[model samples]
Target: MTQVHLLDSIFTRLVAWSIAVCTAVVLILGTLVGAKFEQLSVDMQEAAVNADMATLLDAYRDGGQASLASRIDERLNFRTPSGNAPHYLLVAADGRRVAGDLTDWPGIDTGEMTAIPLPDGSYVHARAVDLPAGQRLLVARESAMDEMVLNEIGIAFVIGGLFVVLAVGVAGRITAGRLSKRVGRINAAFKNPDERRLERLDRDRNAQDEIGELTRHSSEALQRLNRLVDAHRDTLDQIAHEMRTPLMHLDARLLRAIRTAPDDAAAQGLVDARGDIRTVIATLESLLDISHSEANRGDPRGLEPVDLSAMIENIADLYAGSAEETGHRFEVDIAPGVTVRGEEMQLTRLVTNLLDNAFKYTQSGGTVCVELVAEGPVLTVADTGPGVPVEDRDRIFERFIRAKGNHGASGGSGLGLALARAIARRHGLVLRLKPTLRGACFEVRPESTVDAG
Candidate 1:
């Protein structure tokens, strides 16, 4: 049985599309949020820097340049909520630092918010003012603390998004696996209809889901089909049985007529009539065998472990003299202990029918081969003669259909292979006509990869 896996169908598609959409949304939102945070951090730092510069200008007007320098030192000593003190730069007309942490004037236009890089890879968001008496003042906030906040935000969102995607994937797999197993159980018996397997399988058939409805419909349909087949088999079986006795009585009357014939021509005519009656009787028997086998397929009541090797060997022994008398070479390769559960009588008829077909077509000096392998209980019968045409291969197994050319057997009612296949299917086996380079070959195996019908 070919099982459906979660990764093969809808579940895989669901996971893949979810990951794609989730990643895209995360990337877009993460970029926007990070950019917005950086903008707000810069705006707040610029506001504080501008306020400090305004206060220093007031101090410059009140207590002169010395008062301004004093205010800058006081501000640098005080730290903010972020635990980083402000940066300051005071410059004279000669472009030299007056009293601040910065060594030189950073290249910036006055009265604008600017980020100046420090020697230690951090940045200070600053604002500068061209002050009174050709001097300058710059006030700044250390923005590296805001960068750290932004980094933590990015890391948290990445981890959280990936965790969510993984959780969803795991849930999808579990749900799909449960559904697949349930559906597989509901359909397994239907897939093996060749053996007429119709076990009572009901997996949530009353829950009103699509699978439940499907299960109910399949069960009902199979039941209806089974009833029709049973009725047909019963009618045909009864008809064959009723006709067989009168045919036998007619055969006895023909035999007596042949004995009392007044001339050889008259006796020969009666013999022909008897032979015709025998053909009809053989055809009816074949039909009954087919109906019986098909009706009882998959029923294990009368099955037993039969030594297939011994059975084929015995049948071959009986055909050996016939092959010699016709001057055809018969080859046999019987592997011992090839046992399988089946009706021995039906299996014997299957082998016999195949061998009979092989011998019926092969000319004198031709070859016939029989091989039995222990594994698979595989059996092959090949004959060196004109093989069946490609167009006729499938129909030859059909009841009452025969090929009129090449390998077609004379005087056949066209039910031998049909009966053989029915018997093979009844025992959970397959019988198929295998194509060969020269002549016809038939193989019987436990199962076939393709439909031989």
Candidate 2:
């Protein structure tokens, strides 16, 4: 897994997009409402001013124009009977100034209430009406207070919108983080594709959400797949057990026929047939060994701390006669007390498989070296032969797979290294091909690659 940058994270992107949507919505709605605030404020102010205008018009109708003049003068002086203070304008049809505080008609749109600016750099909301005899009556209120309150409300909306966006971002972060963690657990479960090693994904199994359902399905699928794999392994084991008897009987019959052959040539043919049967038996046994190791990989039940140094020395001694027979120089570099917890027989087979490959692949007079070190308790077996191609390094560890460009020897059944790797993994270690300037090198190290079964 690699570190994801903040901007690259889907959670961060969602948060940013959410904040953007919130801001856009707020600004759009606020603009729509804000554009109407001045007019809306004017309409509210019109209610009070219109009532005052009605009273003055009633005065003019009941007690003549003189009574209206007197009322306007009293209203300007704050002495009017009206509860609200309002400014006024009255004009004749000739544009003659009627009784009012204003020097002239402040010409503006009429009928509906609208905002108007006065010379003092202040706003007023006013409405004009046609009176009798072509007279025009205008009513207005100074709107500084209304504008102040509206400005404050706009500021509040902006602050509130920012807070809402922040809250949304926090929520998005938490939700995204939780989802990422759940998905990460699923990834960890399938990280190892090996069916035997892959863990079951079983988080939130009872949950009704998508991830929970996915986990449930994944676990079920894994169980079915593992069952099928176990069945297949059982069938192979049964077949190997069934075949071993016939191969042993055939080998015995060939041995008996070879002793009673009519001549040396007839005996030689029997010997070759026996050798072919023996090869088949060895391949079948190797397959069974690999299967057993893989099935119990990481099981610590029967493991013992075996001294790797002594084990390598013993195997080397066993191969000493073969080394002498082939005129190959056998080199040993064993670090004493290099011990590891493992099945002794499986561990011994692991050593033998690597050494066998070395001896089988190397030419006469070539060098085969075995090394064990305490640092990793690492074991290394190097041979002087045509080295494995870089591309085939990993493939050669697979059962029945051999390097395409080898030293002209079809390494027997090609399961030696595969079985070796299986045994190493069973003991919670890693067996790998080491890149060497000389012939092939195989290494088994205390590289923990498994957990307890």
Candidate 3:
């Protein structure tokens, strides 16, 4: 069974998408908030600079140029709440050196707040106004505190966003893992419908969730399918039983007619008819055997440790003489101590069917080999003949399906491989046709170590 991992399930993907969407929203909102904070900082600085400019203008109006220059000097040395002094520049009518720190007035419109680069390589927000007698009053303030505040807000957004991503991502992964485990439990319950163990499954079908609904619907469908399969198998068994009686009676009558025939030609005709009837009976018997094997696949009573190496050797010995008489080469490579748990009769038939198929299809003077390896309880039967065609390889194990151009001298009913596969499955084994360079190779082996001794 293929495992359903958390990362491979739909729940995990949905969680990831949700996290991505949330992260994007957080980033967008954080950016907007940060922008608003920066804007507020700029507004407060601009208002402070405009108020200082208004104070200098009032001083100039009351105390003339000299008094305004003196007021500028006083304010320049005064510290604000943030411990940064303001800057001032007073330029004369001829744009000469004024009575403040700046050498010349800035070329800015009256009352326009803009960044002014100072001689110390630092910038300040300033507002300029025309004074009496072509003098210019430029009042400015340092903006370092505003930059620091904006930087702090940006840092906080980054830290908060990262924390949210980590917390939500971990939570989502944990939730998805839990969901995957519940889904796996449902899958385990559905693996074997014949067991009818869905009702015994440990699931919360009453909870209002997608998983609960899925579990309920799956259980219902499996129950219905199982009921239909049981009914169909019962119908087939009844029909086969009903036909077996008539077939036996018909065979007895045919034998009596052959014995009482008046002429050799009439007797031969009766014999042929009996052969045809026997073929039909054989087909029906095979069908019943296949059905029985499938129905009893899970039955523990049919399982026993059988020496597969010994069984293959016995079959090879039985067919060796027939192969040599037909001018064919027969070989066996059986390894001792190769044992597997299965029905002895069915395992023997499985090996015999493979050998029969190999010997039937291979031409005279061809080679047939049967091999058993201790490892994996693996058995291989290979024949040097026309290999199965690529198109027919998939269907060759199906009942009544024969490979194209393979109707050899010994006629076949085409149930040999099908029965072999059925017996293999009933024994928890895998039987497959392997590709070969010159001919065909069929392999049979236990699917797991539990099936092998």
How many clashes show up in model 1?
Answer: 0
Query: What value does the lDDT take at residue 305 in candidate 1?
Result: 96
Model 3 off-target regions past 4 Å? 83-85, 94-111, 118-120, 194-202, 236-278, 290-327, 333-348, 371-380, 386-398, 401-408, 421-439, 443-453
TM-score, candidate 1, is 0.81
| TM-score result, candidate 3 | 0.77
CA RMSD, predictions in order: 4.2, 7.6, 5.3
Q: Write the per-residue lDDT of candidate 1 for residues 207-260, one digit (tens) a residue.
A: 587777887887777667667767987888789878998999999999999999
**Per-prediction TM-score:** 0.81, 0.58, 0.77
Stretches of candidate 1 above 4 Å error? 12-29, 61-64, 81-84, 192-203, 252-270, 287-307, 339-346, 374-378, 386-409, 418-437, 445-453
The deviation in Å at residue 383 for candidate 1 is 2.2
Worst lDDT 10-window in candidate 2:
191-200
Best by TM-score: 1
* Deviation in Å, model 1, residue 230 alpha carbon: 3.2
Question: Which pairs of residues have clashing backbones in candidate 2?
Answer: none
Number of the candidate with higher lDDT, 1 or 3: 1
Given candidate 2, what's the lDDT at residue 27? 86
